[model samples]
Structures are given as C-alpha cells and as structure tokens.
Target: EAGVTQFPSHSVIEKGQTVTLRCDPISGHDNLYWYRRVMGKEIKFLLHFVKESKQDESGMPNNRFLAERTGGTYSTLKVQPAELEDSGVYFCASSQRGLARSYNSPLHFGNGTRLTVT
Candidate 1:
C-alpha cells in the first residue's frame, strides 16, 4: 500500500509563469483532493475528485488554477500566470471511498510541494 506522492517537491517561478504539480494517489483509492496553505492563511481545500470526476471545485480561487484527475489514477494542478499570492505549500491527499456515510476513512497526505512565486 503506497501513500500519496507529489512530484517536484518544490518549485520556484516568476510571476506570469505556469507551473504544473502532480500527485499520484495510493493504489485503489478513489477520492483525491487538493489543498494549499499560503503564508498567512490556513490550509484550504482547492478541489475534490471522486475517481475521474470533479466532485467539488467551489474553493478554487480563480480562473488561473485548474485541477484534473484523468483516469482516476493521478492528478495534476496547474497554475498559469502565477501570482505572488499563489505561493504556498500545495498538498495532495487521498482516501478510499467509504461504504457508508458514517464510516470515516483517514486521508493519506503527500509531502507538500512548496511553490514560490517571485
């Protein structure tokens, strides 16, 4: 059983550049989510995916950010024309879809990828 894995581990980019972060969830997990914490803010949910479908994207800040889970295996979060406010630690997490509403599955989180936008 593998835990979540995020690529690049860290990234530094100038404003207006594009950066794509990748996450590979644990095998057999069907729920994948994206989160982030900016310097002065608490970690916030960016999006959720149940398998290959976007479950909730209400937390996304703007049009410059995009998240996708294609084929229900791995996911990618892309930030285009990155801004200073986008600098933060990006986290990816996964959990098995529970059989019942009362059953809680703990989420396995990847070591976040730190994005520095200068």
Candidate 2:
C-alpha cells in the first residue's frame, strides 16, 4: 500500500496570501484526517474525512481554512489569507476501514507540509 504523501514539503507565503496543501492517502483507504502542530503547541486535529463526506471538522481554526476530499480520493487543505500563527507542520493520515476502528492501528502520517507565513 502506498503511504500518505504530501506536496511542497515546505512552503513560505506572505500574510494575506492563499496556500493549498495536498494529501494522497493509501489506495482503498476510507479514512483521512488532517492535523498540525504549531510552534510550542501539541499536535492538533483539524478535520476528518470519511470518503467524500467530512465526518468532522470541529478542529478547523477559522473561516479562512477550508478542507475537502473531492471524489473520496485525494484530499486538500487550503488556508486563505494565511496568518503568522499558521506557520507550522501540517500532517495527513489515513487507514483502512477495518483498521480505522482499531486503536492499535494508529494513523499513518505523511512527512508533513511545513508552512511559514510572514
């Protein structure tokens, strides 16, 4: 199985600009999630997408952020008007439906997309 993949390993954008991060999960996986760790903060959950449906997005930071799992395949997380506080490592993860329910089958993570907003 292909592990999760993220694009642009790192990005730098000025404040007020928009940026889009991409994630490609393992084939046949039905669960995808986005998370991040800003500066001194612990890793935080951003959202969960089960197929094309956003199962939960309660962790979204603000209205400027948007996430989608188009066609239930690859997913994308976009941040518009990026803020200085948005600088951080964004991670993507996925698991098979069978493994998703297993606490032992922890999320497989991508290296992460590090964003820097100035």
Candidate 3:
C-alpha cells in the first residue's frame, strides 16, 4: 500500500560527472515510468519498463542516460557525463500493468529527484 519512493531528493553535481537516481514503486505494480521536467519546460516522458523489460525508451534524451529495472522491483536511472541541460526534476511513476494504458488507470508518483549540474 505504500507509494513510490525516490532517493536523494536533491543532487548537485559538476558537468561531466555521473549521477544515479533510484525509484522503488508500489508493490504489485507492473508498469514503471520515468519522466523529467527541464527548466521552464513541461514534464516529458523519458522511458518505461514493464516488469524487467524495457517497454518503451524512445523518449530518453541521449546515450549518456541509462535506465534499468532490477528484478522488476526497483528501478534506476543513471546519467553519465552530466550536462547542465540535464538538470531537472526526475519523476518516477507506477501503475498496474493492464490498467496503465487506459484513461481510468491512476499512476502513483514519487516526490521526484531534483538534479542540478553546474
């Protein structure tokens, strides 16, 4: 019954450094998603995982970013050679597998991790 949880609510790193964000979704949820909102921009989808497989990753920004779901229980997002443009609030969400794509499904979200690249 717990909601999604994200670690390191805030992070400040230098450009070219590497940072990893973690997310633990609600138990029994089968669909996980990553999203971010850059300065002055609306939140945008980054990627999605269904169980341990990546269901969609077309929204990922670039090659420097990597996403993984371990054992279909928790997820991680790593950004290497971080750029200032990558600074934003990264959000994690989850929903039941079959209900995810439907309008009636509700996605539970984490508080989000705020990353700042200097």
* Model 1: per-residue Cα lDDT over 2-112, one tens digit each: 789999899999999999999999998999999998888899999999999999999999999999899999999999989999999999999989667323888899999
Expressed as tens digits, the lDDT of each residue in 1-118 for candidate 3 is 7999999899999999999999999998889999999889999999999999999999999999999998999999999989999999999999886643555668899999999999
Better structure of 1 and 2 per TM-score: 1
Clashing pairs in 3: none
Global local distance difference test of model 2: 0.92
lDDT by candidate, in order shown: 0.94, 0.92, 0.94
My TM-score estimates for the predictions, one after another, are 0.95, 0.93, 0.94
Which lDDT value does model 2 have at 30? 84
Candidate 3, RMSD to the unseen true structure: 1.6
> Candidate 2's error at 107, in angstroms?
0.9
lDDT tens digits, residue span 22-57, model 2? 999998888999999998899999999989999999
Point out the worst 10-residue segment of candidate 1 by lDDT. 98-107
